[model samples]
Target: MSFFSVKGLSKHFGGLVANNSIDLDVEKGEIRGVIGPNGAGKTTFFNVVSGFYTPTSGTVEFKGKVISGLHSSKIAKLGAVRTFQRAALFPEFTVLENVIIARHLNADTSLLNAIFRHNTKAEAGNLARSKEIIEFLGLKDEQDNLALNLSHGHQRVLGVAMALATEPELLMLDEPVAGMNSSEKAVMVGLIKKIRDTWGITVLLVEHDMKTVMSLCDKITVLDFGEKLAEGLPEEIINNDKVIEAYLGADDIVA
Candidate 1:
C-alpha cells in the first residue's frame, strides 16, 4: 500500500460537483505534485485530505488507516498535516511562539500541571522538540520577530514551519510558492527538497508554477474541472496532448 491513498474520491455542493471520482497515491518520502488550470479541484482535494470537507463518496487511507470523515484536528494528529494557500499565522505572536504552539498538538501535559507549576517530562521534551524545529526551519535568527513584522517570504516560511512542527508523515502544501518572486521560489524549492530528504516525509503539493512542479516532483497528477486528466512522470505529463489541451485550449491543440 502507498503511504497515502485516495480511491474514488468525490465532493459535491448542492448541484455543483467540485470533485469527481479521483484516485491518487503518494509513496513514502516522495514529492508528488498536482497541477491543472484554475478550478481544477486541486484545493478541493487538499480539503478532503485535510478534513475540511468529508468526501460525498470515497475513502482516504493514510498509513493504512481510514481518515475519510475525521475532524481536521483528528486528522492532523494522525500524522497528516497541510498548510493553506495564504499564510496563516498569529500576527501578534513571535515566530518562535507560533512554531511552539503547533507542537502543542501532541503535548501530553495537562493544563493543571502548567497552572500548578508542576514539572512534567512531556513538557520538557516538547520544548526541546520545538527548539529543534525552530533551527530546522532556519528561523533561529528571527525567532523573536513578530509574525506581522516579517517579510512576506519569511511569513510564508513561518507558516510552513508551523505545519512541520506537527511532525507529520504526510505533508500537504497548497501552493507554497504562489506569490513568491523567482528568487524566493528558488529558495522554497530547495527547502522543500531538504524537508523530504532529511525528514523522510511524503509531500503532496498543489502548485501553479509548471516549471518548478516539473522539476521537483517525482510524479505529477493533472486535474481538469474537478476530474482526473492525466497522471505520469514530469516528462510524460509535459508532453501529454490532453494536458496541453486542458491548459491551453482544444482549438489551440487542433491548430
Candidate 2:
C-alpha cells in the first residue's frame, strides 16, 4: 500500500461540489505536489486529507489505517500535520517559544507531572528539539525575535518549524513558498528538501507556483474544477494537453 492514500474523496456544500471523487497516492519519503487554478478544490482536498474537513464521501488512509472523518487534532496525533497558506504563529511570542509550544502536541505531559515540575526533562527535550528545528530552517538568528518582528518570509519559515515540532510522519504544506521573492522561495525549497532527506518525512504540498512545484516534487497531481485533471512526473504534467487547456492564460503553469 502507498504511505498515504485517498480514495473517492469528495466534499460538497449544498449544490456546490468542491471536490468530486478524487484519488491520490503518495509513497513514503517522497515529495508530492498538488496544483490547480483558483477555486479548483486543491485546498479543499488538503483540508479533507489533513482532517480539517470530513469528506462528504470516501476515505483517507495513512500507513494502512483509515483516517477519514477524523478530527484535525486526532489526525495530527496520528502523525499527519498541515501548515496553512497564511503563516499561523503566536505573533507576540519569540520564535523559540512558538515552536516550544507546538512541541507540546507530542510532549504528553500529565497535569500532575506539570504541577510537581516532574516534566522538566520533557521541557528540556522540547527546547532542544525546537532549537534544532529553528536552525534546520535557517532561523537560528531569529530565534529570540518576536514572531511579529520577523520578515514575511521568516514568518512562513517559522510556521514550517512549528509543524516540524509536531514530529509528524507526513507533513502537508499549503503554499509554503507563496508571497516571497526569488531568494526566499529558493530557501524554502531547499529547506523542504532537507526536511524530507534529513528527517525521512513524507511531504505533500499544495502550491500554485509552477516552477517551485516542478522543481521540488517527485510527482505532481493536477486538479481542475474540483476533479482530478492529471497526475504524473513534472515533465509529463507540464506537457499534458488537458492541463494546458484547463489552466491556459489563467495560471502560470506553462511558464
Candidate 3:
C-alpha cells in the first residue's frame, strides 16, 4: 500500500461539491505536489486529508490505517501534520519560544508534572529540539527575535519549523513559498528538499507557484473543478493539454 492514500474522496457544502471522487497515492519519502486554478478544491482536498474537514464520502489512509473522519488533533498525533498558507505564530513570542510551545504537542508533561517542576527534563529536551529545528530552517540568527520582527519570508520559514517541532512523519505544506521573493522561494525549496532528504519526511504540497512545484515534486497531481484532472511527472503535467488549458497557462509552462 502507498504510505498515504486517498480513495474516492468527496466533500460537499450544501449544493456545491467541492471535491468529487478524488484518489491519490503518495509513496514513502516522496515529495508530491497538488496544483490547480483558484477554487479548484486543492485546499479542500488538503483539509479533508489532514482531518481539518471530514470527507463527505471516502477514506484516507496513512500507513494503512484509516484516518478519514478522525479529528485533526488525532490525525496529527498519528504523525501527519499540516501547515497553513498563512504563517501561524505567536507574534509576541521569540522564534525559539514559538517552536518550543509547538513542541508541547509531542511533549509528555502533565499538569501535575508542570505544577511541581517535574517536567524540567521534558522541557529541556523540547528546547533542544526547537533549537535544532530553527537551525535546520536557517533561522538560528532570528531565534531570539520576536516572530513579528522577522521578515515575511522568515515568518513563513518559522511556521515550517514550528510544524517540524511536532516530529511529524508526513508533513503537508500548503503554499510553503507563498508571498516569497525569488531568493526566499529558493531558500524554502531547498529547506523542503532537506526536510524530505535529510529528515525522511514524506511531503504533500499544495502550491500555486508552478516553478517551485515542478522543481520540487517527484510527482504532480492536477485538479480542476474539484476532481483529478491529471497526474504525472512534472514534465508530463506541464505538457498535458487539459492541464495546460485548465490551469497552467500556455505561457506559464517553462520549456
Candidate 4:
C-alpha cells in the first residue's frame, strides 16, 4: 500500500456532491499537489481525507489502515495531520507556546502520570521537540512573539511549525502559501522541500499557485467539477490538454 491513499471517496453536502468518487495514491516521502478551479472539490477532498469531514462513500487509508470516518484527533494520533487554508494557531499564545501546546498529541494524559507528575520527562521532551520544530520552520527568531503579532507570512509558517510538532508521517497542507508575496512564497516552497527531504515526511497539498505546485510537487493531481480530471508528474500535468482546459484556460496555459 502507498503511504496515504483515498479510494473511491465521495462527499456530499445535502444534494450537492462536493467530491465524487475521487481516487488518489501518494507514496511515502513524496510531495503531491492537488489543484483545481473554484468549487472543484479540492478543499472537500482535503477535509474528508484529513478527517474534518466524513466520506459519503469509499475509504481513506493511511499506512494501510482504514481511517475513513475517524475523528480528526484520532487520525492525527495515527500519524496523519493536516493544516488549513488559514493559519490555525492560538492568537494570544507565543509562537513557542502554540507549538508546545500542539505537542499534546504526544503527551501523557493518564491520570496516574498526571497526578504523580510522572510526565515531567515527557513535558521536557515536548519542549525540546517543539523548539526544534520552531527552528526547523525558521520561526526561531519569533518564538517569543505572540502569534497574532507576527506578519501574515510568519503566521502561516507558525501554523506549519505546529503541524510539524505532531511528528506526523503524513502532512496534508491546504493552500500552504496562500496570500503571500513572492519572497514569502519562495521561503515556504523551500521550507516544504526541507520538510520532506530532511524529515522524510510525506506531503499532500492542495494549492492554487501553479508555479508553487509545479516547482514543489513530485506528482500533481487535477480535479474538476467534483471528479478526478488528471494525475501525473508535474511536467505531464502541465502539458495535459484536459488539465490545461479544465484548470486554466488553454489560452492562459501555465508556464
lDDT of 2: 0.90
Instruction: Give the per-residue lDDT of model 4 (tens digit) for 148-188.
Output: 99999999999889888888999999998888999999999
**Tens-place lDDT digits, model 2, residues 159-255:** 9999999999999999998889999999999999999999999999999888899889999998999999999999998899998888745646433
On the 0 to 100 scale, the lDDT of residue 53 in model 2 is 89
Report how far residue 156 has shifted in candidate 3, in Å. 0.5
Q: What residue pairs clash in candidate 2, if any at all?
A: none
- The lDDT values for all models are 0.86, 0.90, 0.90, 0.88
Candidate 2: deviation at residue 48, Å? 0.8
TM-score to native of every candidate shown? 0.92, 0.95, 0.94, 0.93
Q: Flag the better candidate by TM-score, 2 or 4.
A: 2
Q: Which is superior by lDDT, 1 or 3?
A: 3
Q: Worst ten-residue run, lDDT, model 2?
A: 109-118
Q: Poorest 10 consecutive residues of model 1 by lDDT? A: 246-255
- For model 4, state the Cα shift of residue 207 in Å: 0.4
Error of 4 at 239 (Å): 0.9
Full-model lDDT, candidate 1: 0.86
